[model samples]
Target: MASTDSHSCVVYLVDPQDGKKGTVVPDRFRRLAIADGCGVVGLESADEDGGSQEELTGLIVAAIAAVMERQDPAELGGDGRAKVGAVAKQAGFKVTKVQFDEAWPKYVDGLGADDEDKDGE
Candidate 1:
């Protein structure tokens, strides 16, 4: 589910705790700090995109779908969780993993994956 939505903008999301110690940041715009996805790779991920971008764009798509559905991608089951862990190492998300058989689904198990699950995987 690569999005060719030409109408787009990058938004930087910062955890409040990561702010300068005691510094006050006025509520501002929201942004995505990702690159190598769909179209337009941000400068942030430019240096890191040295041939390791497999499924990175799909990861972004899945993540967006999860948020839209109010589902936490990390807590998803089967294929969803498998895909999440696959990109965790590269995407820099500190998540735990189980065995391979457990990580992936037994079959193609389409449908749910049509919502970007398999593509993301």
Candidate 2:
């Protein structure tokens, strides 16, 4: 939960019955919430930048809400997406899905070695 002395925000990753997980990013604009039943909640942030705590809070809130309304965390990277989803939910943002093929290469250190040539072939 991200919070100030008077307000706080919480994000939740919910796994409803059907053996699938869902994410809920709460908008910072929203302070109170009621969970439906199954899910995990994570708090993202709580601080003001340049005296715009309220604005930042609102952006977080909207982003989380957008994510919950438009994304499926399972599609991104399973648990990682779930965690991000929770944070987004708490902050009120939507999870943006990108093509893995395009994004993976940038972060992947090395391609797997050929099985027959394990000696750095």
Candidate 3:
């Protein structure tokens, strides 16, 4: 999992290999930050080495769609998590954990002010 703006925005990427995880984020999967609100937008790409990047991408997209189509917003979170898990299971790729806090500390600090406020109270 990768977080930006102090963990307000996070992105998760699952590798279609051994499932090893890393959290330094790139611009590609930035849309995942919206997962809690409007749902996440996922994009997947695979190399020609029998990797299931395409499949995984499709699964993520489908998951997002499934979550968005839910009648209640409260259900979106659970549905999204389920969809992500499904994609990982169906695709032969391992998921990479990326975090913006480690990648962009300044950004995270700035974004996390709200968290600080909540914690302070």
Candidate 4:
């Protein structure tokens, strides 16, 4: 998340109480915010090439899938998490492992049973 200052804008899942923000907010939250008519605050970053929500979502998913594809699930450990973070960055999102871990559950839950079953959950 970028520093909260006069110029900085809040993204999707900003906790209002503390004013904490995340740039790579989960799609579920983003959609709800928009559907509820909440204003979206976007920051202009020199590194970021602004993109459509669908495109960005595809990029993020592809990055994760690519990393998972190269590793056996049983063998994936801390290194796997690191690889995911790196892959996300390569795809243009500055995602950390902790952030990914936190947001992933929300993203998964939003998909519900159909997606979960596909994952053998």
lDDT of each: 0.36, 0.38, 0.38, 0.49
Could you tell me the C-alpha RMSD of candidate 2 in Å? 16.5
- Report model 1's TM-score to 2 decimal places: 0.20
- The list of candidate 4 runs beyond 4 A from truth reads 1-51, 72-76, 79-82, 89-93, 96-121
- Evaluated against the true structure, the overall lDDT of model 1 is 0.36
Q: In candidate 3, which residue ranges exceed 4 Å CA deviation?
A: 1-46, 49-51, 77-121
- For residues 1-121, could you state the per-residue lDDT of candidate 4 as single tens digits? 2322323335545676667663444554553333233443464544333333333444455555555557756435664442554555445455556545654554455457657788995
Question: Evaluated with lDDT, which candidate comes out highest?
Answer: 4
Please write out the lDDT profile of model 3 over residues 69-97, one tens digit for every residue. 45344443452332333333332233332
Q: Which candidate leads the pack in TM-score?
A: 4
Location of the lowest summed lDDT over 10 successive residues in candidate 1: 25-34
- Winner on lDDT between 3 and 4 is 4
Q: Residue 90's C-alpha lDDT in candidate 1?
A: 37
Of 2 and 4, the candidate ranking higher by TM-score: 4
Question: What's the TM for model 3?
Answer: 0.25
How far off is model 3, as Cα RMSD? 16.7
